[model samples]
Target chain A: MDTIIIDERIDVGAVFKKNIIKPRWFVWKGRKYAITEVTYTWEDTQGAARVMHFALSDGNTLFEVSLNLTSLEWRLEKSSVV
Target chain B: MTRTILLIDMNAFFASVEQAMNPALRGKPIIVCGRGRTVVTTASYEARVFGVKTGMNLYQAKQACPQVIAVEGDMSRYIDASHNIQRIAREFTDQVEMFSIDECFLDVSKTCRNEVDPQNIARAIKHTIREKLGVTCSIGIGPNKVVAKIASKMQKPDGLIEIREKDIPVLFALMAVQKLQGVGVGRHISEKLMSMGITTAGQLGNTPLEKLMHHFGIMGYRLKRIGEGKDDSPVDSSGGNELIKSVGHSHTFPRDTRDISIIRSYMMMLTEKVGLRLREYGLMGKTVYCTIRFGDFTSWGAQQGLKEHIRQNREIFFVAEQILARAFPLSKAVRLVGLSISDLKPRDTQQFLLKEMEKDTTLAEAVDDINKKYGVFTIKASSVILSEKFGIRPSCGMVSKQALKIKV
Candidate 1:
């Protein structure tokens, strides 16, 4: 269960005051359901900064968010590809 | 029995709290604003269809929409989403009031005692802020608080409307004599009330409030009681509990600058952050004011008063560097800079007979105890670390601008 998408002018409270919260997912739509409010920023325009973790929820109804330390690429769903 | 008063507001609030947290910023456009180099402190409506707005700047909001999406303001995440919508507007009323930080008001006339329904308690406070702050608000309902803040901006983002008292003269006859509120009007009194045909707010409530006080004085008796929804004003629950006559800080220079030494090093770091929040609110003002804004967004502000009541950040950066050297005019290029202070008092002043002002209040209590234990500039004032090495500092608590994760 992973779906992260966030983008639009970043900063969900400076990415929840600089990330670290994951008790294995459950974040859905309306902006990954406001990732428990605040923290998010992904800059680079002479502003110099790039970071991630948008996992608000992907545990169903397809609502996920990403930014968990940049470098991303994924596609999996063969019964959670065991 | 006129008293329901809702208000609510929020839409486009920091781009709907950054599109409720970022479903690819839902239908794009955003903006947010204010981190320095000023203007545009709220845009989205898909960046107001590319003309972009809220105080403009950010280089004319990236020349009116270069794929908008700016974002900067946070104000502690909109004051923690206005303390979780003032904790669900204190479950419908302790007569709420917050009023700014994306507005709020409530009253709920004795908790809807005359049997609920201020438009279903503004749709149960917009479904308890969309099932607990997923965002979207609007709300309005009215009986006061200036017709519930003009029926909470008349609607957008989860609207609710209400007006009553026989729909205040058909909603002040389809609004607009500058949306008839306080008629701050201008654009030359909306081109002299649209060349005297006076467009709307029912033709300025049928004109003659003595010819709008013979051409606007006392803002034409407050635009004939804001075109008759008549305000009585109340709702000031003294959150700031008065006496802070002033204490300011301003910035607006993400660019445009004809440097008067970078606007006196951002007016000595916003008069050293309004003299460290007026010596951490022990207080002491005696006036100071000093605004600016230029690059055509026009703004000026001045104030003076002093002769004492200081709180020293080198006397509020030499009275905001002599009111930005006689209210600016080094022709163009400034973007903004402010630093208020105003009359206030309370710092229990008494120990003065002077010994070099008790060695400058023991060097401002040893630079406010090493900037409150190694935090702020950690013991500043060598001309505030040479005005933060020639100014514009305030990056507000950095941890490389956090973003480790939570993009959901």
Candidate 2:
């Protein structure tokens, strides 16, 4: 698997129920991909912004998406370009 | 009542976390390593079968296991998983002591008194971890900490052993002396005992205390206790926070370099890290310590004492830089550099004496708040960035956390 860094902002459809973030789908580069499974979830910070990261897979490929809480922005940080 | 201590040792922690997340590399031989570090941090059981071991460089690992897959480890992932596991363990017993990133000790004597079996707790922990986190842990339960830690390692991947108080003698008789690490016995001490025909824990325990003391001095008494599986150490939930003698950070160069600019940049970077940690812990120190290791690994270090306690990175770096410039051998290419502070005391909560002092404190606090919410290095000095440009990022090489603590 080859990893490609793609720090691009995207639109994510997610559920925030009881402090849990489950990303259902995201639109990146004009293509909407339904998240088949959330492989990994972790958290980080940028300055004062809490960022939640999720490694989402749409069956064949995996993409790491991060959401900055302060700005409420979703970004595609990187992807396992298979 | 005898304490029931359980040591939960995660099996191949970093590699296991990677496998848990990806799933594709579940059964394959894999070695988890950090970027720019050739040393393997953790190797999977499949890799261990091929003789691959932690700390082995990539070349040596490939030589041992040609098919081993190399994965760059993410510390945040492991830390998060560890936190979750610790949270789970606390559900059973409040006396959970985090031993390391992948290991912990639980004093279940109180919990067990409630009629809950230690084995059931261990089994439940194992089941919950495997089901929720996709990893397994080996748990060893004994009357004390030492035996519990040793027993945990007896089985791999997913194993549990409960050593009763009466089982010490029989168990020690069969166990090798070399197997005991960080349990009151040093390697050279073990070797010395072995030369005296003491090849097992039983033999070591049976050796005359007077004779052992005559040879090893004060440490001999501790060694004897370890040999008999007699450890009374409590499961300290403080997690060594109260035991921190100093907050320090060090980095080794990828290659030895005598460049003044690079050295200074790295020193400033290290000082920043130490200073940040000190402030985070609400600590102030009156002395600055700096060390330099040459190309041949011979080290030289010196400490500078300040008039007043300081926690600011700039102030600490100022002293650290002078100590390095005045003492370090300029002719020698530097392989590693370290910066630390001693004579630590809690930071004063009093109001600043001067307006400038208050301004500086406010600025520092604001920056810290911003970084805490955002991420580390979000607002760092330009010199720190220079260290990165020079290719000397923090946690640079084989200087593991355990290795760093050894020197201090």
Candidate 3:
């Protein structure tokens, strides 16, 4: 997969269940998309900042999203469709 | 009494992980490769069927299978999967030796309970790996590691085989002598053995030891034991599961160059990678080694030991440059340059270096912190800043979960 590093900030809504964080919806580029399923979840560390990377599907498109814990910011790191 | 050993080999590991994570890549011909690299690191079963094999350049792989999809390999994903697999293996036996990123050996002799057969344990391990990891593996159960390793490769994709002592003679009678593990005596010796009418493992095993030793020296004894399906090596699981021998990185230039500046910059970049890994693992080494592969494929390496153990980029690069200079006055253009630090020991106490050393240590810590927070290369030494400009990407070779010791 070609990983395009897009560090632009985006809006994300997540749910905390049983100490697990799941992304429910996200907004990017003035568009709101509801996540249908999360294909994979992984944790990455950047210095002291911990980021949660989620490969989520919005029914038609697959997007890779990252949430920075220290900054509490969400970024769309990559996308599989186009 | 024979001890039970099991070898678990992941099928097309990198490609399989890519397929497992991406639904779009499933069942399609895929080849995992480094960016701008022609060599195929791993090929899916779909691509392999069309004659695409590991180490085949992209041009050759495409020639064999035009529809092959090339994906840049992500070492982190493979490393994570390997850790999960190792955890699964530990559920059966604590004696799990991670052979590589995609293979491991487990000594289940002590853990094989009275009611369950050794084969059953292998089956359970395979089942859990498939269900949890969404990947398949072939497992081989044998009286020892060598036989288990050979049996693991007997079937492709997903296979299970058990090799008993009684099965050795018949199973190896038709097997090529070269198929035996640790028999890589090269083509000349293989040809000599073939000339002696020793083409099969059974023949090699049955050959007189004195004659074999007279022909091949000490290696002949190892060959005989491997041919007889005997391996006395134990599965080592000390040091939190993975035993790391060395931390190093090597980059092959797209075009062979003789420019000293370019080569030095590449060396600096590699030393940074090695140093980062060393500090990450809380390890330090006394020896600095450098390797240079010329355009003719002939390689030369040199190493030097330091009185003080080091895990900093500047120190590693300084020592590596010294070693490289010792092998200098290049006879030809350099194709690849690699740096590694061996003779490793855990970092314990620091020696006082007065002002300069303390300043360097503080700077290194700050830089490491920033890079670890942002991403690698977010902050790098000025000497290595041109590494990306020169297309000197960090090499990802056989990443093991044990290598990445993430501190939680």
Q: Model 2: per-residue lDDT, tens digit, B1-408?
A: 788999999999889988777655779998987655567889999999999998798999999998888876766677677777888788888888877778889999988888889999999999998888889999999999999988898898799999888999999998889888666677887888889888999888888889889999988888888888898888877545454577777787766788888899989878767877788889999988998888776889999888999988878888988898885458788878988898999999999789998888888888777767666677788877777876754234232223212111
Q: Considering the true interface contacts (CA pairs under 8 Å between chains A and B), give the fraction that model 3 also has.
A: 0.40
Candidate 3 deviant stretches above 4 angstroms: A1-7, A19-21, A48-50, A69-72, B181-192, B239-245, B252-259, B277-286, B293-300, B304-312, B325-335, B343-379, B390-395, B404-408
Candidate with best DockQ: 2
- Give lDDT: candidate 3, residue B72: 72
CAPRI quality of model 3: acceptable
Question: Candidate 2 lDDT (Cα, whole model)?
Answer: 0.82
Q: List the candidates' TM-scores in order.
A: 0.29, 0.89, 0.86
- List iRMS (one decimal) for every candidate: 12.2, 2.6, 3.1
C-alpha local distance difference test of each model: 0.64, 0.82, 0.82
lDDT of 3 by residue, B164-185 (tens): 8899999989898667643344
RMSD of each candidate relative to the true structure = 21.7, 4.0, 3.5
Evaluate candidate 3 by giving its C-alpha RMSD to the native, one decimal.
Answer: 3.5
